[model samples]
Target: MSELLSVQGLTVTPANNPGKKLVNNVSFTLQSGKTTCIVGESGSGKSLTALSVMGLLATSLNRTSGSIQFQGNEITHLSNDALSRIRGKQIGMIFQEPMTSLNPVLTVGFQIGESLTVHLGLKGDALKAKIAALLEQVGIPPERANAYPDELSGGQRQRVMIAMSIACEPKMLIADEPTTALDVTVQAQILALLDELKTRMNMGMLFITHDFGVVADIADDVLVMFRGEVVEAGSVDEVLFKPQHPYTKALLDCVPDAEGKKQLKPIDYSWLEAA
Candidate 1:
């Protein structure tokens, strides 16, 4: 697979507090048809890192330093207009909460068609046809396109979000805890759908999650972050089975075994103070 995205020396911090880093010198590469999972607890800079790549960092925060290259082109400093052109067309992002991310006032069909209309200039019958196809693609019935965000179940709302993200057939997809709100069965279904879509579209996926279960289910490569830094990075097997960083091992120990045989351990950060 070809390289789809390359992030080097990426850093983020509050605009007023440049000395304090929220994300420090983090780097990784994503290849087409592959999923790279960034696993960490809250405030570990996982979401901030993804937001920086999409040029969606909060106004109060600054990228500080980084180079984000997509399709061999630098995008870290692209203007708003330039980024807008690529945002929904070449790169799609599914935010953490579908209810918050999606506009409640609009119909789901309209929401899904927005990108098709703007980025692809699709309209009229062609637009309607495409929206229905996308809905079906994500396992939602085409008829449900008329439903509002609140009208759908948690899983359905997420499926709608997935449909919107893939509507324009972007080369890269960023999903930030897409399945966190769903039940176990639904979560598994969403994971499978995302994997299938990635393979079918040959799109590179950057999945952010705190769940080690999720990392095991979908990641081809893994990056373990703690306190805003990548403490370890490698293939899923290498990082999960042969962790070299203290933080990585601690995080893994917290995951309970399927048979309820292994004891769950709280994360130990004593090594941080020593380092």
Candidate 2:
């Protein structure tokens, strides 16, 4: 029930426009063992907000105001090394594209072990054992650990990415459209995987996605972002069924209903593939 991370009055500006803020007064709290989803259309600064909390924002941008605290400790001003240590070890990231986030030359085993080596100080047989366990945990075959990224299917590649992210067993997992670029069934499988892992690891997850369908499926709490601000936020039922904001209602109204199509489930969208 404790807050894992809290962002308050957050505002950031790109180097190009010191006067113009891209993220405006955004605030949210991610509690332990719960999933807080930020749903918004493209360019709404959902990912930016996640990056800011993770201390993974690009050097070209600066936090002009507000505070980001993790486990009750302020991180917005932490040294680069301190933040990096926390970024992957205490907080893991699953980017939108697995192909881009993963290594081109390294085998799946190596990428998964990379984090263990860096954060957990694992090596040799211990590292191999851990990597295999991670692969299996994420639903990848043990044999596939030796395979390269390009040689695997989209879903398989994503599994590898997940394995790598959870290698350190971080307290928080920030997934920026993690299911993007997969088939419908694959998306469900991946979501189920995340749900299972979150429960097992007791992790606080900040899932950033444009898909309301996903929000309906997996979110514990929802924040609807628009034009650099949260337009609506509440429990899923409140935000989805009884949306209070016009923008939130508009976004929800855009969700496709497949009641007429027997094969199309309302909550089943192919977010496994990139939109």
Candidate 3:
């Protein structure tokens, strides 16, 4: 598989405290038709890493170093306009919270069609057909396009978000804890749907999450983050079943087995720091 996205020596720092690096020397590559998951507890810089890749970081945060290459193009220093041209069209993003990411005033279809209109120049019957197909693809009824974001259930709203992200047939997708707010069944459905779509489209997927179970289900490659650094990285089976880092082992121990047979153990940060 070809490399779809690559990041090298990526570093993010708080503007107020230039000395404090929030994301330190991160590096990874995502291949076409593959899902690379970045997993860690909250405050481990997972979301910040994703934002830096998308060029969506807050003004208060800055990428002080590193290069981001996408589809054979360098994106680390592209102008905002250049980035915008590629953002939704070639690189789609599914934010953590669908309710907050979506517009409350517009109908679901309109929001989904927005990018199609902007990127593909579709209109009239063509745009409508595309929107309907996207909604259907995500398992939402085409009729629900007329409904507001608040009217839909959490799972449905997320499905709509998925529809919006894939509207342009992007080459890569960035998903930031996309299933964090859903129930177990819905989470499973969403993960399965994403995996299926990724395979069908041959799109590279960068998924951020704290759940090891989700990683086991969807990831082709796994990168474990701890305190702004990549503590461990390997194939899903290798990292999940035979972690090298103590932090990785501690994290694996925290995940409960399906039969509830494995005892859940909290990470010992004090010992982690000592090591």
**Candidate numbers, best lDDT first, in rank order:** 1, 3, 2
Candidate 3 segments exceeding 4 Å error:
260-264
The parts of candidate 2 lying over 4 Å away from their true place are: 260-275
How far off is residue 118 in model 1, in Å? 0.2
- For model 3 the local lDDT of residue 191 reads 97
- Please, what is the TM-score per model? 0.97, 0.93, 0.97
lDDT of 3 at 68: 94
lDDT digits (tens) for residues 1-275 of candidate 2: 66899999999899788887889999999988899999988998998899898777898998889898899999988988998999789998898899898889999899898879999899999999999899889888898888999999999898888888889999999999988788879999999999899999999999998988899989999999987888888988899999987677767767767662323234323432333
Model 1 scores worst on lDDT over the 10 consecutive residues at 258-267
Query: Per model, how many backbone clashes are there?
Result: 0, 6, 0
- lDDT scores of the candidates, listed in order: 0.93, 0.88, 0.93
Candidate 3 residue-wise lDDT, 121-238, digit = tens: 9999999999999999999989998999999999999999999999999999999999999998999999999999999999999999999999999999999998899989999999
Tens digits of per-residue lDDT for model 1 on 68-182?
Answer: 9999999977899999999989998997789998899999999999999999899999999999999999998999889999999999999999999999999999999999999
Worst ten in a row by lDDT for model 2: 260-269
Model 1, runs deviating above 4 Å: 260-264
